[model samples]
Target: MSQPKARRSQLISTYGIGGLFPSSTTSYMIAGLHEWKEDRAEPLSEPRLARSLKVVALKQPPAGGRKDVPVIRFPYTQVCPSCRRIGRLHELSKDWNIAECSKDKQPLNPFRLILACRRGHIDEFPYFQWLHRGQGKAGSDHLMKLEARGRTSSLADLVLTCTCGVENRNLDGAIGPLADFGTCRGSRPWLGPETEACEEIPRVLQRGASNVWYPAVRSSISIPPYSEALSKFVDRHWPLLADREVVTPALLARVAELSDGKYSVDQIVAELDRRRGEEQEEDDLSEARLRSGEYSALIEGRDEEDIDADFVCLPRDVPADFDRLITDVRKVTRLREVRALYGFSRLEGAGGSESNLCPLAPTHTNWLPAIQVIGEGIFMAFDRDELARWADKSFAKDRARMLKVAADRNAEEYGHAPKHIDIVEVAIHTLAHVIIDQLSLDAGYPAAALRERLYVDDNMAGLLIYTASSDSAGSLGGVAAMAETDRLGNALAEGLVRLSWCSSDPVCIESKGAGSDALNLAACHACVLVPETSCEKSNSFLDRALLFGTRDGGNESEGIFSHFVASAVGA
Candidate 1:
């Protein structure tokens, strides 16, 4: 009792979610940060206090304008569970360059939009941007369609706030989901916690409540000297456009000071002017400063420090070393500590070409087992059937009682309740993985044979049991895999690791398949990316992921790439 309770307790506390559980052992999820402060709240923005007003979206605040921190309407609460929708509302820097989307030149990572809540009706539609990264039009008016709808019932949208009381007008971009809390008369085990299910999400959001939210990396490159310099120039010149009025020589001096004599005031001003002029035309803002006296001060290229290459964007007179320093600094700290934990950085390849920034792999935690069963491919085919029979009402009753206590204690008035779907999913995957490894070991399958027969054989299957399905929410499946839910898989992988290093059976990665995971050389770990591939796209979500096969889009299928196959030939 203590061990199981302790494990669940560990999960809840790790997330700092007191409002989610019926007791310490009942694991519940959280949304915002751990606390809320009044200062972070906006003064009830009047972005829509009009009978008729035109709105526009921006990748960043217009050049030289005041800090109009651009906002995207990514739903932290996934309005639609399965698909390749882009409306996760994540942020894109204002400086990223790409050919316009309208020209059929793909905007990197462009996603479609789904599900819009207007009044009580949910008008779900898919929206795609037809422009370049920073060179496209924003659908501000598009979101207004939702706001125009009447208010919702108790469980509906209202004020949205961060744990720090920083009111995020739209949902934070796509949050990796952890578990589901379905509607119910009471709580259940799988969803973890039960407290405060009655409370409306938006209301709790306004006060900065937590729900399965993971901090994500927000700023990707494009900071430092150029951003700082332009910030100053915009402040001094574009008073109305700046986030704060009164950008002065002091701000410009700060930017220059940091540049180490690599950038000049003149260069900074010109870059801002060039970019600003183009964007302002869309919003119809005047860019008279280009020809006004403001342009006079930037005539000479005065000395500024070196700009770091990692932050290199529309480069100014900044030097090469500046970029190096930024690269070093990024590895240690998150750019936007609250919103994101990592960024997409370019690393130099052996060929010396830039490679995409790789996301760090997730690790297993206390409840997570080190291994899982093997030989469970056939079992997955029975998932829809097996789950139906495994819904134990007796266990659910205990789970519900525990959950109700949580709701009462947390003071929640509205929200979805816990569901048993996850429990069955977890149980089956865990059982399958365990059985596979055990069966293989008992049959005296050598480590090499185990790899071939259990891991790679088409008829032979294994589960990345702890991992989330392609459509899973809240840090996706990484959270579960880290929890060590599958025992058999963990054990088998361990046995293989020992034998392979001894040179008995070389445990290279799988390469011949379509839906597989890739092994990281440096970390010596196999990682799976979901909904990122085409094969992993489910039958129900086929149209949603819009997966193109090797013939159509590119990859095998759409969904999480659980079956990792490396690029180099012959394992």
Candidate 2:
């Protein structure tokens, strides 16, 4: 069969291993990492990412190679469009060459519904079991058919029938908790011929449901020291030094000699030491630590003579009009972001339990799939002292407590970890959304293409609005250009103005809570919410009321930027 093409980045984000994609003929799931031909894939060096994921190395997905990613046909049951007869694809077809109706020769369509469990096991729907309902034994001889009575486009109109004279069943009760699809067989088809014993009940889902596949991706921005030439050179040659029992002066001298005097022996030795120190500093790296490194780099800025370094930032003056609210601005003219996929889960959100996450390969693999995107961005730091005072306000605490209550309830209901809600984080996050919405219009990038990175904690108050693309070597400076005093001031002003009044006003702003699980307050699609891809927290914990205070009858509570907005309006 001819293989379909996918972008190298998509293999990690959209269609990584075990992910299902549709071809012209049928749908197929990407095979496990064990099936991938490593030679066709290029090696990617991202030590921080490897350490965070606890993997030895990373590799870019193969594209335009002699061999491509392997795939296995999914939802093996194929239904004849003409006769409505349903059976396994292998049984319906005479051989691998043909996949059409055996009797009518009509093209076959894959059964839309499949079974999955919280544990990430998936299997074809138990058709024989459902058709027989345990009344009698079912076998290959008993032909089954799926008939859709075109009366209404509902599952109730869809019927599954068997030739054994058992009572037919409709698909009405086949999808939810009441589903009798039976226990999961723990099938790991992507890894090939693997099935385990599972006791969890399987839920029926459409083949293309969003919850069917959620790739747990971890990303880090290449910053300072790490982005420098000498550091990168060490990263490339570390495997050589790493294999040795010890890095002696002789080995260091040889490595420096191989550089042909481009780097001094002292510089190489220092870079290697730094790398080793970072590895030894922590056994498990956290996301906060990764962002902390990037935050420091952006704040200090970097102007390298090499010009080809992965990261280059130039500090810019804060817009005069918004200087009180904004502290610093950095124009990141060049940046590289590395994203690696560690594992994936089915029927769960990105924060599912580690035990439930399916393996990328049949066994432990040292390398993971990753991709790097180069781009530019505008990083703006808020006045931390001012933010701290604002977060201490009674109204800010109340609003934050409300959102925290919602988040805690959501966590309890969903069985996920409770979210840590900081009033400063909420305001900064909402500000990031409003600014991203404005930057989308001014920066020449769609909201989806633009992404936000929030730096809000006890010590840091900032956000980075950046656009990265794997297809381009670097960005066109649209985002970074907006960091200029005049453009950025206008963008911030316009963003504040836009947030002052949502189109869904009163109802939207007055609401105690809104959005998924009521985890948001005074925020919705009509106002602060951006594309899922653009947001870090899935558009949760946002409250425009926190940015521009809310009024209830005679009482008004001031927000973080309420004074700025009031002064701008000459109130």
> Clashes in each model (backbone N, CA, C under 3 Å)?
100, 0
Q: What are the candidates' C-alpha RMSDs?
A: 26.9, 2.5
**What tens digits encode model 1's per-residue C-alpha lDDT throughout 242-272?**
3334546677666566657766767655655
- Candidate 2, residues 372-441, lDDT tens digits: the string is 9888999999889988887887888888899889988888886777888898998999999998899888
Q: Which stretches of candidate 1 lie over 4 Å from their true place?
A: 1-245, 248-262, 278-307, 311-571
- Candidate 1 shows a clash count of 100
The prediction achieving the highest TM-score against the true structure is: 2
Evaluate all candidate structures by whole-model CA lDDT and list the values in order: 0.23, 0.84
lDDT of 1 at 455: 17
lDDT for predicted candidate 2 compared with the true structure: 0.84
For candidate 1, the TM-score is 0.22
